[model samples]
Target chain A: MVEIATIVLILVGTFLMFVAGLGITRMPDLFLRMSATTKVSTLGMGAVMLAVVIYFDDLVATFHAIAIILFVFISAPVAAHVIGRAAYFTGVPLWEGTIVDELRGHYDLRTHQLESVPLPELEEHLPDVQVLKVLLPATSPLAGQTLAQINMRRRYDVTVLAIRRGDRMITNPGGDAQIQPADELILIGKSAKLDEVVSILRGLAR
Target chain B: MTPVQGLVVFVAFPLLTIAVILAFVRLVRGPSLPDRVVALDLISTLMIGIIAVYAIATDEPVLLDLAIVLALISFLGTVAFAHYLERRV
Candidate 1:
Protein backbone atom coordinates (compact mmCIF):
# COMPACT_ATOMS: atom_id res chain seq x y z
CA MET A 1 0.00 0.00 0.00
CA VAL A 2 2.84 2.39 0.91
CA GLU A 3 4.62 1.54 -2.32
CA ILE A 4 1.50 2.29 -4.34
CA ALA A 5 1.04 5.58 -2.56
CA THR A 6 4.65 6.52 -3.25
CA ILE A 7 4.26 5.65 -6.89
CA VAL A 8 1.12 7.70 -7.13
CA LEU A 9 2.81 10.69 -5.57
CA ILE A 10 5.79 10.42 -7.86
CA LEU A 11 3.61 10.06 -10.95
CA VAL A 12 1.50 13.08 -10.11
CA GLY A 13 4.62 15.08 -9.32
CA THR A 14 6.21 14.18 -12.65
CA PHE A 15 3.02 15.11 -14.48
CA LEU A 16 2.94 18.50 -12.80
CA MET A 17 6.57 19.12 -13.67
CA PHE A 18 5.82 18.17 -17.26
CA VAL A 19 2.88 20.54 -17.37
CA ALA A 20 5.11 23.30 -16.06
CA GLY A 21 7.55 22.59 -18.86
CA LEU A 22 4.74 22.76 -21.38
CA GLY A 23 3.54 26.02 -19.91
CA ILE A 24 6.97 27.59 -20.10
CA THR A 25 7.44 26.53 -23.70
CA ARG A 26 3.93 27.41 -24.83
CA MET A 27 3.10 30.58 -22.89
CA PRO A 28 3.19 33.65 -25.07
CA ASP A 29 5.20 36.03 -22.88
CA LEU A 30 7.72 36.21 -20.07
CA PHE A 31 5.25 37.12 -17.33
CA LEU A 32 2.96 34.23 -18.21
CA ARG A 33 5.93 31.88 -18.29
CA MET A 34 7.00 33.10 -14.88
CA SER A 35 3.49 32.46 -13.62
CA ALA A 36 3.67 28.93 -14.95
CA THR A 37 7.14 27.92 -13.75
CA THR A 38 7.00 29.43 -10.28
CA LYS A 39 3.86 27.85 -8.90
CA VAL A 40 3.58 24.63 -10.89
CA SER A 41 7.21 23.55 -10.68
CA THR A 42 7.45 24.40 -6.99
CA LEU A 43 4.43 22.27 -6.25
CA GLY A 44 5.83 19.49 -8.41
CA MET A 45 9.09 19.48 -6.52
CA GLY A 46 7.21 19.47 -3.24
CA ALA A 47 5.25 16.42 -4.28
CA VAL A 48 8.36 14.60 -5.44
CA MET A 49 10.04 15.36 -2.14
CA LEU A 50 7.04 14.06 -0.28
CA ALA A 51 7.37 10.82 -2.20
CA VAL A 52 11.00 10.60 -1.15
CA VAL A 53 10.04 11.01 2.48
CA ILE A 54 7.45 8.25 2.20
CA TYR A 55 9.73 5.89 0.29
CA PHE A 56 12.76 6.15 2.55
CA ASP A 57 10.81 6.42 5.84
CA ASP A 58 13.92 7.80 7.53
CA LEU A 59 14.00 10.83 9.77
CA VAL A 60 17.00 12.47 8.14
CA ALA A 61 15.64 12.15 4.61
CA THR A 62 12.28 13.46 5.70
CA PHE A 63 13.94 16.42 7.39
CA HIS A 64 15.86 17.26 4.25
CA ALA A 65 12.77 17.01 2.10
CA ILE A 66 10.81 19.23 4.48
CA ALA A 67 13.55 21.83 4.49
CA ILE A 68 13.63 21.88 0.71
CA ILE A 69 9.88 22.26 0.54
CA LEU A 70 9.99 25.19 2.94
CA PHE A 71 12.72 26.93 0.96
CA VAL A 72 10.93 26.42 -2.35
CA PHE A 73 7.63 27.67 -1.02
CA ILE A 74 9.22 30.81 0.35
CA SER A 75 11.43 31.74 -2.60
CA ALA A 76 9.52 30.85 -5.75
CA PRO A 77 6.83 33.51 -5.61
CA VAL A 78 9.31 36.20 -4.60
CA ALA A 79 11.54 35.30 -7.53
CA ALA A 80 8.62 35.47 -9.93
CA HIS A 81 7.59 38.85 -8.58
CA VAL A 82 11.10 40.27 -8.94
CA ILE A 83 11.45 38.91 -12.45
CA GLY A 84 8.09 40.28 -13.51
CA ARG A 85 8.95 43.67 -12.04
CA ALA A 86 12.27 43.68 -13.88
CA ALA A 87 10.60 42.79 -17.17
CA TYR A 88 8.10 45.58 -16.74
CA PHE A 89 10.63 48.24 -15.67
CA THR A 90 12.94 47.26 -18.52
CA GLY A 91 10.11 47.88 -20.98
CA VAL A 92 9.59 44.31 -22.09
CA PRO A 93 6.55 44.52 -24.32
CA LEU A 94 3.41 42.87 -23.11
CA TRP A 95 1.78 40.19 -25.18
CA GLU A 96 -0.74 41.62 -27.62
CA GLY A 97 -3.48 39.61 -25.99
CA THR A 98 -2.90 41.34 -22.65
CA ILE A 99 -5.70 43.81 -22.06
CA VAL A 100 -4.33 45.54 -18.97
CA ASP A 101 -0.95 46.73 -17.75
CA GLU A 102 -1.04 47.36 -14.00
CA LEU A 103 2.47 48.73 -13.61
CA ARG A 104 3.05 50.53 -16.88
CA GLY A 105 4.31 53.88 -15.60
CA HIS A 106 4.39 53.15 -11.89
CA TYR A 107 7.99 51.96 -11.72
CA ASP A 108 11.40 53.57 -12.16
CA LEU A 109 13.54 51.73 -14.69
CA ARG A 110 16.94 52.77 -13.35
CA THR A 111 16.32 52.24 -9.65
CA HIS A 112 13.99 49.28 -10.06
CA GLN A 113 11.56 50.91 -7.66
CA LEU A 114 7.99 52.09 -7.69
CA GLU A 115 7.34 55.75 -8.36
CA SER A 116 4.96 57.37 -5.93
CA VAL A 117 2.40 59.68 -7.37
CA PRO A 118 3.14 63.15 -6.11
CA LEU A 119 0.22 64.52 -4.15
CA PRO A 120 -0.79 67.97 -5.27
CA GLU A 121 0.56 70.76 -3.06
CA LEU A 122 -2.44 71.76 -1.00
CA GLU A 123 -2.25 75.40 -0.02
CA GLU A 124 -5.22 77.14 1.47
CA HIS A 125 -3.94 80.52 0.20
CA LEU A 126 -3.58 79.54 -3.41
CA PRO A 127 -7.04 78.60 -4.70
CA ASP A 128 -10.15 76.65 -3.77
CA VAL A 129 -10.02 74.52 -6.93
CA GLN A 130 -7.49 71.74 -6.65
CA VAL A 131 -5.38 69.78 -9.14
CA LEU A 132 -5.81 66.07 -8.51
CA LYS A 133 -3.67 63.29 -9.95
CA VAL A 134 -5.83 60.24 -10.49
CA LEU A 135 -4.18 56.86 -10.99
CA LEU A 136 -6.06 54.25 -12.99
CA PRO A 137 -5.68 50.66 -11.95
CA ALA A 138 -5.58 47.80 -14.42
CA THR A 139 -9.13 46.74 -13.54
CA SER A 140 -10.52 50.20 -14.27
CA PRO A 141 -13.27 50.01 -16.89
CA LEU A 142 -11.84 53.15 -18.47
CA ALA A 143 -8.86 51.13 -19.65
CA GLY A 144 -8.64 50.53 -23.41
CA GLN A 145 -11.45 53.08 -23.78
CA THR A 146 -10.94 56.62 -25.02
CA LEU A 147 -11.50 59.63 -22.79
CA ALA A 148 -14.01 60.92 -25.34
CA GLN A 149 -16.05 57.76 -25.01
CA ILE A 150 -16.13 57.94 -21.21
CA ASN A 151 -17.08 61.62 -21.37
CA MET A 152 -15.68 62.35 -17.90
CA ARG A 153 -16.65 65.98 -18.24
CA ARG A 154 -20.32 65.11 -18.61
CA ARG A 155 -20.25 62.32 -16.05
CA TYR A 156 -18.05 63.69 -13.26
CA ASP A 157 -17.55 67.38 -14.14
CA VAL A 158 -13.76 67.00 -14.03
CA THR A 159 -11.47 67.93 -16.91
CA VAL A 160 -8.53 65.69 -17.86
CA LEU A 161 -5.85 68.32 -18.49
CA ALA A 162 -2.96 65.92 -19.14
CA ILE A 163 -2.14 62.25 -19.06
CA ARG A 164 1.16 60.98 -17.71
CA ARG A 165 2.45 57.64 -19.06
CA GLY A 166 5.94 56.24 -18.59
CA ASP A 167 7.85 59.51 -18.32
CA ARG A 168 5.97 61.18 -21.19
CA MET A 169 3.22 63.69 -20.56
CA ILE A 170 0.42 64.38 -22.96
CA THR A 171 -1.00 67.85 -22.36
CA ASN A 172 -4.52 68.59 -23.47
CA PRO A 173 -5.17 65.16 -24.91
CA GLY A 174 -7.58 65.44 -27.80
CA GLY A 175 -10.82 63.48 -28.14
CA ASP A 176 -9.03 60.69 -29.95
CA ALA A 177 -6.63 60.14 -27.01
CA GLN A 178 -6.99 56.80 -25.25
CA ILE A 179 -6.74 56.20 -21.51
CA GLN A 180 -4.55 53.25 -20.69
CA PRO A 181 -4.37 51.22 -17.51
CA ALA A 182 -2.11 52.75 -14.84
CA ASP A 183 -2.35 56.11 -16.59
CA GLU A 184 -2.21 59.13 -14.30
CA LEU A 185 -4.92 61.51 -15.32
CA ILE A 186 -4.11 65.06 -14.26
CA LEU A 187 -7.48 66.48 -13.46
CA ILE A 188 -8.42 70.01 -12.48
CA GLY A 189 -11.75 70.61 -10.85
CA LYS A 190 -13.54 71.33 -7.57
CA SER A 191 -12.64 68.83 -4.85
CA ALA A 192 -16.22 67.50 -4.84
CA LYS A 193 -16.08 66.71 -8.56
CA LEU A 194 -12.64 65.15 -8.17
CA ASP A 195 -14.03 62.93 -5.42
CA GLU A 196 -16.78 61.85 -7.77
CA VAL A 197 -14.22 61.07 -10.48
CA VAL A 198 -12.26 58.98 -8.01
CA SER A 199 -15.34 57.00 -7.09
CA ILE A 200 -16.16 56.42 -10.74
CA LEU A 201 -12.66 55.24 -11.53
CA ARG A 202 -12.82 52.87 -8.60
CA GLY A 203 -15.74 51.17 -10.35
CA LEU A 204 -18.29 52.71 -8.04
CA ALA A 205 -21.28 54.80 -9.11
CA ARG A 206 -22.12 58.14 -7.54
CA MET B 1 13.85 -3.18 -3.41
CA THR B 2 10.46 -4.74 -4.07
CA PRO B 3 9.14 -5.30 -7.57
CA VAL B 4 6.58 -2.49 -7.30
CA GLN B 5 9.15 0.03 -6.08
CA GLY B 6 11.56 -0.91 -8.87
CA LEU B 7 8.88 -0.60 -11.50
CA VAL B 8 7.74 2.75 -10.13
CA VAL B 9 11.26 4.16 -10.18
CA PHE B 10 11.82 2.85 -13.69
CA VAL B 11 8.73 4.56 -14.96
CA ALA B 12 9.21 7.82 -13.01
CA PHE B 13 12.88 8.39 -13.81
CA PRO B 14 12.33 8.49 -17.54
CA LEU B 15 9.37 10.81 -17.18
CA LEU B 16 11.30 13.18 -14.95
CA THR B 17 14.22 13.08 -17.34
CA ILE B 18 11.95 14.09 -20.19
CA ALA B 19 10.63 16.94 -18.13
CA VAL B 20 14.18 18.15 -17.51
CA ILE B 21 15.01 18.08 -21.19
CA LEU B 22 11.86 20.02 -22.01
CA ALA B 23 12.79 22.67 -19.47
CA PHE B 24 16.22 22.83 -21.10
CA VAL B 25 14.61 23.58 -24.43
CA ARG B 26 12.92 26.57 -22.86
CA LEU B 27 16.19 27.72 -21.32
CA VAL B 28 17.83 27.85 -24.74
CA ARG B 29 15.02 29.74 -26.46
CA GLY B 30 15.47 32.85 -24.24
CA PRO B 31 13.19 35.20 -26.21
CA SER B 32 14.00 37.32 -23.15
CA LEU B 33 16.49 37.20 -20.26
CA PRO B 34 13.98 36.66 -17.43
CA ASP B 35 12.50 33.75 -19.35
CA ARG B 36 15.93 32.21 -19.38
CA VAL B 37 16.28 32.78 -15.64
CA VAL B 38 12.90 31.21 -14.97
CA ALA B 39 13.89 28.20 -17.03
CA LEU B 40 17.10 27.93 -15.06
CA ASP B 41 15.14 28.01 -11.82
CA LEU B 42 12.86 25.26 -13.11
CA ILE B 43 15.87 23.17 -14.11
CA SER B 44 17.31 23.42 -10.61
CA THR B 45 14.01 22.43 -8.99
CA LEU B 46 13.74 19.53 -11.41
CA MET B 47 17.24 18.48 -10.44
CA ILE B 48 16.15 18.39 -6.81
CA GLY B 49 13.23 16.17 -7.75
CA ILE B 50 15.56 13.90 -9.69
CA ILE B 51 17.96 13.64 -6.77
CA ALA B 52 15.10 12.81 -4.41
CA VAL B 53 13.93 10.07 -6.74
CA TYR B 54 17.45 8.69 -6.85
CA ALA B 55 17.64 8.59 -3.06
CA ILE B 56 14.34 6.74 -2.96
CA ALA B 57 15.37 4.17 -5.57
CA THR B 58 18.77 3.53 -4.03
CA ASP B 59 17.40 3.56 -0.43
CA GLU B 60 20.33 5.75 0.55
CA PRO B 61 19.51 8.26 3.23
CA VAL B 62 22.85 10.03 2.76
CA LEU B 63 21.88 11.06 -0.74
CA LEU B 64 19.16 13.21 0.76
CA ASP B 65 21.92 15.37 2.23
CA LEU B 66 23.09 16.26 -1.24
CA ALA B 67 19.50 16.99 -2.22
CA ILE B 68 19.14 19.38 0.67
CA VAL B 69 22.31 21.23 -0.20
CA LEU B 70 21.30 21.39 -3.85
CA ALA B 71 17.92 22.81 -2.93
CA LEU B 72 19.43 25.51 -0.70
CA ILE B 73 22.06 26.44 -3.28
CA SER B 74 19.51 26.64 -6.09
CA PHE B 75 17.39 28.95 -3.98
CA LEU B 76 20.39 31.19 -3.39
CA GLY B 77 21.18 31.17 -7.10
CA THR B 78 17.57 32.06 -7.92
CA VAL B 79 17.65 34.93 -5.45
CA ALA B 80 20.89 36.17 -7.01
CA PHE B 81 19.36 35.95 -10.45
CA ALA B 82 16.36 37.90 -9.24
CA HIS B 83 18.73 40.54 -7.93
CA TYR B 84 20.43 40.65 -11.29
CA LEU B 85 17.12 40.88 -13.07
CA GLU B 86 16.24 43.90 -10.93
CA ARG B 87 19.64 45.41 -11.93
CA ARG B 88 20.71 45.33 -8.28
CA VAL B 89 23.80 43.21 -9.05
Candidate 2:
Protein backbone atom coordinates (compact mmCIF):
# COMPACT_ATOMS: atom_id res chain seq x y z
CA MET A 1 0.00 0.00 0.00
CA VAL A 2 2.84 2.40 0.79
CA GLU A 3 4.48 1.51 -2.51
CA ILE A 4 1.35 2.29 -4.47
CA ALA A 5 0.93 5.58 -2.70
CA THR A 6 4.54 6.47 -3.39
CA ILE A 7 4.01 5.80 -7.09
CA VAL A 8 0.98 8.06 -7.15
CA LEU A 9 2.90 10.89 -5.43
CA ILE A 10 5.84 10.54 -7.81
CA LEU A 11 3.58 10.72 -10.83
CA VAL A 12 1.87 13.84 -9.66
CA GLY A 13 5.17 15.51 -8.78
CA THR A 14 6.64 14.67 -12.18
CA PHE A 15 3.65 16.13 -13.99
CA LEU A 16 3.92 19.40 -12.08
CA MET A 17 7.64 19.69 -12.77
CA PHE A 18 7.03 19.17 -16.46
CA VAL A 19 4.43 21.90 -16.44
CA ALA A 20 6.93 24.28 -14.82
CA GLY A 21 9.42 23.67 -17.61
CA LEU A 22 6.78 24.42 -20.20
CA GLY A 23 5.81 27.60 -18.41
CA ILE A 24 9.45 28.75 -18.35
CA THR A 25 9.73 28.36 -22.11
CA ARG A 26 6.36 29.84 -22.97
CA MET A 27 6.36 32.78 -20.57
CA PRO A 28 6.50 36.17 -22.31
CA ASP A 29 8.95 37.90 -19.98
CA LEU A 30 11.73 37.37 -17.48
CA PHE A 31 9.50 38.20 -14.52
CA LEU A 32 6.82 35.81 -15.73
CA ARG A 33 9.32 33.05 -16.34
CA MET A 34 10.76 33.48 -12.86
CA SER A 35 7.27 33.50 -11.38
CA ALA A 36 6.34 30.24 -13.07
CA THR A 37 9.63 28.57 -12.22
CA THR A 38 9.78 29.55 -8.53
CA LYS A 39 6.17 28.70 -7.76
CA VAL A 40 5.62 25.54 -9.81
CA SER A 41 9.13 24.09 -9.63
CA THR A 42 9.40 24.56 -5.86
CA LEU A 43 6.06 22.83 -5.36
CA GLY A 44 7.10 20.00 -7.66
CA MET A 45 10.33 19.52 -5.76
CA GLY A 46 8.48 19.55 -2.43
CA ALA A 47 6.08 16.91 -3.63
CA VAL A 48 8.86 14.64 -4.84
CA MET A 49 10.77 15.06 -1.59
CA LEU A 50 7.63 14.28 0.33
CA ALA A 51 7.21 11.13 -1.73
CA VAL A 52 10.68 10.00 -0.75
CA VAL A 53 9.90 10.59 2.92
CA ILE A 54 6.76 8.51 2.54
CA TYR A 55 8.63 5.71 0.80
CA PHE A 56 11.17 5.41 3.59
CA ASP A 57 8.77 6.06 6.45
CA ASP A 58 11.85 7.23 8.33
CA LEU A 59 12.16 10.31 10.49
CA VAL A 60 15.60 11.22 9.10
CA ALA A 61 14.48 11.29 5.48
CA THR A 62 11.37 13.17 6.42
CA PHE A 63 13.36 15.80 8.24
CA HIS A 64 15.76 16.15 5.34
CA ALA A 65 12.89 16.65 2.93
CA ILE A 66 11.35 19.25 5.15
CA ALA A 67 14.63 21.12 5.43
CA ILE A 68 15.10 21.17 1.66
CA ILE A 69 11.54 22.40 1.14
CA LEU A 70 11.99 25.21 3.63
CA PHE A 71 15.26 26.23 2.05
CA VAL A 72 13.70 26.35 -1.38
CA PHE A 73 10.77 28.38 -0.11
CA ILE A 74 13.13 30.97 1.35
CA SER A 75 15.69 31.09 -1.45
CA ALA A 76 13.66 30.87 -4.62
CA PRO A 77 12.13 34.32 -4.37
CA VAL A 78 15.45 35.92 -3.46
CA ALA A 79 17.18 34.28 -6.43
CA ALA A 80 14.40 35.35 -8.76
CA HIS A 81 14.64 38.89 -7.48
CA VAL A 82 18.37 38.98 -8.13
CA ILE A 83 17.98 37.68 -11.68
CA GLY A 84 15.13 40.04 -12.50
CA ARG A 85 16.96 43.05 -11.09
CA ALA A 86 20.10 42.20 -13.04
CA ALA A 87 18.16 41.82 -16.28
CA TYR A 88 16.40 45.10 -15.71
CA PHE A 89 19.60 47.01 -14.92
CA THR A 90 21.35 45.53 -17.95
CA GLY A 91 18.68 47.00 -20.24
CA VAL A 92 16.98 43.78 -21.27
CA PRO A 93 13.71 44.91 -22.78
CA LEU A 94 10.51 43.54 -21.35
CA TRP A 95 7.69 42.01 -23.40
CA GLU A 96 5.25 44.40 -25.04
CA GLY A 97 2.50 43.05 -22.86
CA THR A 98 4.07 44.71 -19.82
CA ILE A 99 1.56 47.30 -18.67
CA VAL A 100 3.91 49.15 -16.34
CA ASP A 101 7.61 49.39 -15.57
CA GLU A 102 8.17 51.14 -12.30
CA LEU A 103 11.89 50.51 -12.45
CA ARG A 104 12.27 52.13 -15.85
CA GLY A 105 10.44 55.23 -14.71
CA HIS A 106 12.54 55.48 -11.58
CA TYR A 107 15.80 55.07 -13.49
CA ASP A 108 14.72 57.63 -16.07
CA LEU A 109 14.01 60.16 -13.39
CA ARG A 110 17.46 59.63 -11.87
CA THR A 111 19.14 59.95 -15.26
CA HIS A 112 17.26 63.14 -15.93
CA GLN A 113 18.52 64.53 -12.66
CA LEU A 114 22.07 63.67 -13.63
CA GLU A 115 21.62 65.28 -17.02
CA SER A 116 20.32 68.47 -15.41
CA VAL A 117 23.54 68.88 -13.45
CA PRO A 118 26.00 71.15 -15.26
CA LEU A 119 28.87 69.25 -16.87
CA PRO A 120 31.62 71.68 -15.72
CA GLU A 121 30.48 71.46 -12.13
CA LEU A 122 30.21 67.69 -12.36
CA GLU A 123 33.77 67.44 -13.63
CA GLU A 124 35.02 69.88 -11.03
CA HIS A 125 33.34 67.90 -8.27
CA LEU A 126 34.85 64.56 -9.30
CA PRO A 127 38.58 63.83 -9.60
CA ASP A 128 38.73 60.60 -11.66
CA VAL A 129 37.21 60.14 -15.09
CA GLN A 130 34.02 58.10 -14.67
CA VAL A 131 34.22 54.65 -16.14
CA LEU A 132 31.97 51.94 -14.75
CA LYS A 133 31.15 50.61 -11.31
CA VAL A 134 33.08 47.45 -10.53
CA LEU A 135 33.59 45.36 -7.38
CA LEU A 136 37.11 44.99 -6.02
CA PRO A 137 37.98 41.35 -5.57
CA ALA A 138 40.33 40.43 -2.74
CA THR A 139 43.03 39.56 -5.25
CA SER A 140 42.79 42.85 -7.13
CA PRO A 141 45.93 45.02 -6.97
CA LEU A 142 43.90 48.09 -6.16
CA ALA A 143 42.40 46.43 -3.12
CA GLY A 144 44.60 48.32 -0.68
CA GLN A 145 45.66 51.39 -2.67
CA THR A 146 44.56 54.93 -1.94
CA LEU A 147 42.93 56.85 -4.80
CA ALA A 148 45.95 59.12 -5.20
CA GLN A 149 48.44 56.23 -5.33
CA ILE A 150 46.43 54.25 -7.89
CA ASN A 151 46.39 57.41 -10.06
CA MET A 152 43.57 55.86 -12.10
CA ARG A 153 42.75 59.11 -13.89
CA ARG A 154 46.33 59.48 -15.17
CA ARG A 155 46.93 55.77 -15.78
CA TYR A 156 43.67 54.57 -17.30
CA ASP A 157 42.06 57.93 -18.06
CA VAL A 158 39.18 56.79 -15.83
CA THR A 159 37.78 58.78 -12.92
CA VAL A 160 35.93 57.51 -9.91
CA LEU A 161 32.56 59.26 -9.90
CA ALA A 162 31.52 57.84 -6.57
CA ILE A 163 32.24 55.09 -4.13
CA ARG A 164 29.48 52.82 -2.88
CA ARG A 165 30.55 51.21 0.37
CA GLY A 166 27.71 48.94 1.21
CA ASP A 167 24.51 50.93 1.66
CA ARG A 168 26.27 54.26 1.98
CA MET A 169 27.72 56.44 -0.76
CA ILE A 170 30.94 58.45 -0.57
CA THR A 171 30.38 61.07 -3.27
CA ASN A 172 33.36 63.10 -4.43
CA PRO A 173 35.72 60.97 -2.44
CA GLY A 174 39.09 62.34 -1.41
CA GLY A 175 42.25 61.48 -3.33
CA ASP A 176 43.51 59.61 -0.27
CA ALA A 177 40.43 57.41 -0.10
CA GLN A 178 41.51 53.79 0.06
CA ILE A 179 39.85 51.12 -2.03
CA GLN A 180 38.55 48.10 -0.14
CA PRO A 181 37.21 44.70 -0.96
CA ALA A 182 33.55 44.54 -2.07
CA ASP A 183 33.50 48.31 -2.57
CA GLU A 184 31.68 49.27 -5.76
CA LEU A 185 33.35 52.13 -7.66
CA ILE A 186 31.29 54.25 -10.01
CA LEU A 187 33.64 55.38 -12.79
CA ILE A 188 33.26 57.38 -15.97
CA GLY A 189 35.37 57.63 -19.14
CA LYS A 190 35.45 56.69 -22.82
CA SER A 191 33.98 53.22 -23.29
CA ALA A 192 37.01 51.35 -24.65
CA LYS A 193 39.40 52.93 -22.18
CA LEU A 194 37.00 52.15 -19.34
CA ASP A 195 37.11 48.49 -20.29
CA GLU A 196 40.86 48.46 -19.91
CA VAL A 197 40.60 50.26 -16.60
CA VAL A 198 38.12 47.74 -15.38
CA SER A 199 40.36 44.87 -16.40
CA ILE A 200 43.24 46.42 -14.60
CA LEU A 201 41.22 47.00 -11.44
CA ARG A 202 39.88 43.45 -11.45
CA GLY A 203 43.31 42.02 -12.14
CA LEU A 204 44.59 43.88 -9.10
CA ALA A 205 44.70 42.21 -5.60
CA ARG A 206 43.60 38.93 -7.26
CA MET B 1 8.77 -4.07 -10.20
CA THR B 2 5.08 -3.83 -9.51
CA PRO B 3 2.77 -2.42 -12.16
CA VAL B 4 2.15 0.71 -10.15
CA GLN B 5 5.86 1.38 -9.61
CA GLY B 6 6.46 0.73 -13.29
CA LEU B 7 3.85 3.31 -14.13
CA VAL B 8 5.76 5.92 -12.18
CA VAL B 9 9.32 5.02 -13.26
CA PHE B 10 8.48 4.65 -16.93
CA VAL B 11 5.55 6.98 -17.43
CA ALA B 12 5.95 9.89 -15.05
CA PHE B 13 9.73 10.15 -14.90
CA PRO B 14 9.99 10.06 -18.68
CA LEU B 15 7.47 12.85 -19.09
CA LEU B 16 9.29 15.01 -16.56
CA THR B 17 12.61 14.28 -18.25
CA ILE B 18 11.23 15.48 -21.55
CA ALA B 19 10.09 18.72 -20.01
CA VAL B 20 13.43 19.24 -18.30
CA ILE B 21 15.23 18.61 -21.58
CA LEU B 22 13.12 21.27 -23.24
CA ALA B 23 14.09 23.73 -20.55
CA PHE B 24 17.72 22.74 -20.91
CA VAL B 25 17.49 23.55 -24.59
CA ARG B 26 16.26 27.01 -23.68
CA LEU B 27 19.13 27.44 -21.27
CA VAL B 28 21.58 26.63 -24.05
CA ARG B 29 19.96 28.90 -26.61
CA GLY B 30 19.00 31.77 -24.33
CA PRO B 31 19.73 35.19 -25.85
CA SER B 32 20.63 36.74 -22.51
CA LEU B 33 22.34 35.75 -19.29
CA PRO B 34 19.33 36.15 -17.02
CA ASP B 35 17.18 33.98 -19.29
CA ARG B 36 19.75 31.23 -19.14
CA VAL B 37 20.08 31.58 -15.37
CA VAL B 38 16.32 31.30 -14.90
CA ALA B 39 16.14 28.24 -17.16
CA LEU B 40 19.00 26.56 -15.36
CA ASP B 41 17.25 27.16 -12.04
CA LEU B 42 14.05 25.59 -13.36
CA ILE B 43 16.01 22.61 -14.66
CA SER B 44 17.65 22.06 -11.27
CA THR B 45 14.29 22.10 -9.51
CA LEU B 46 12.90 19.61 -12.01
CA MET B 47 15.91 17.39 -11.46
CA ILE B 48 15.12 17.29 -7.75
CA GLY B 49 11.68 15.95 -8.55
CA ILE B 50 13.15 13.33 -10.87
CA ILE B 51 15.59 12.17 -8.19
CA ALA B 52 12.81 11.95 -5.63
CA VAL B 53 10.83 9.71 -7.95
CA TYR B 54 13.81 7.42 -8.31
CA ALA B 55 14.25 7.24 -4.53
CA ILE B 56 10.61 6.35 -4.01
CA ALA B 57 10.50 3.68 -6.73
CA THR B 58 13.61 2.02 -5.35
CA ASP B 59 12.86 2.66 -1.67
CA GLU B 60 16.37 3.98 -1.08
CA PRO B 61 16.77 6.63 1.57
CA VAL B 62 20.24 7.47 0.27
CA LEU B 63 18.78 9.16 -2.79
CA LEU B 64 16.96 11.55 -0.49
CA ASP B 65 20.29 12.90 0.70
CA LEU B 66 21.34 13.44 -2.91
CA ALA B 67 18.16 15.41 -3.61
CA ILE B 68 18.69 17.72 -0.64
CA VAL B 69 22.31 18.35 -1.57
CA LEU B 70 21.42 19.12 -5.17
CA ALA B 71 18.84 21.64 -4.03
CA LEU B 72 21.31 23.51 -1.82
CA ILE B 73 24.11 23.56 -4.39
CA SER B 74 21.77 24.70 -7.15
CA PHE B 75 20.42 27.54 -5.02
CA LEU B 76 23.90 28.77 -4.12
CA GLY B 77 25.05 28.53 -7.74
CA THR B 78 22.05 30.49 -8.93
CA VAL B 79 22.70 33.27 -6.42
CA ALA B 80 26.39 33.49 -7.33
CA PHE B 81 25.61 33.60 -11.03
CA ALA B 82 22.99 36.26 -10.52
CA HIS B 83 25.46 38.37 -8.54
CA TYR B 84 28.05 38.02 -11.28
CA LEU B 85 25.52 39.05 -13.90
CA GLU B 86 24.36 42.05 -11.92
CA ARG B 87 27.90 43.39 -11.43
CA ARG B 88 29.06 42.35 -14.92
CA VAL B 89 32.23 40.92 -13.41
DockQ of 1: 0.48
**What is the per-residue lDDT of model 2 for residues A129-168, given as tens digits with 9 covering 90 to 100?**
3335566667787788899998888987778888888788
Candidate 2 has what TM-score?
Answer: 0.64
Candidate 2 deviant stretches above 4 angstroms? A1-4, A107-206
lDDT of 1 by residue, A65-121 (tens): 888888778877877777777667555667889975545435543345576544456
Worst 10 residues of 1 chain B by lDDT: B3-12
Question: Which DockQ values do the candidates obtain, in the order shown?
Answer: 0.48, 0.53
Residue A120 shift from truth in candidate 1, angstroms: 14
Q: Model 1 clash pairs? A: none
Docking class of 2: medium
The best candidate by TM-score is 1
Candidate with the greatest DockQ versus the true structure: 2
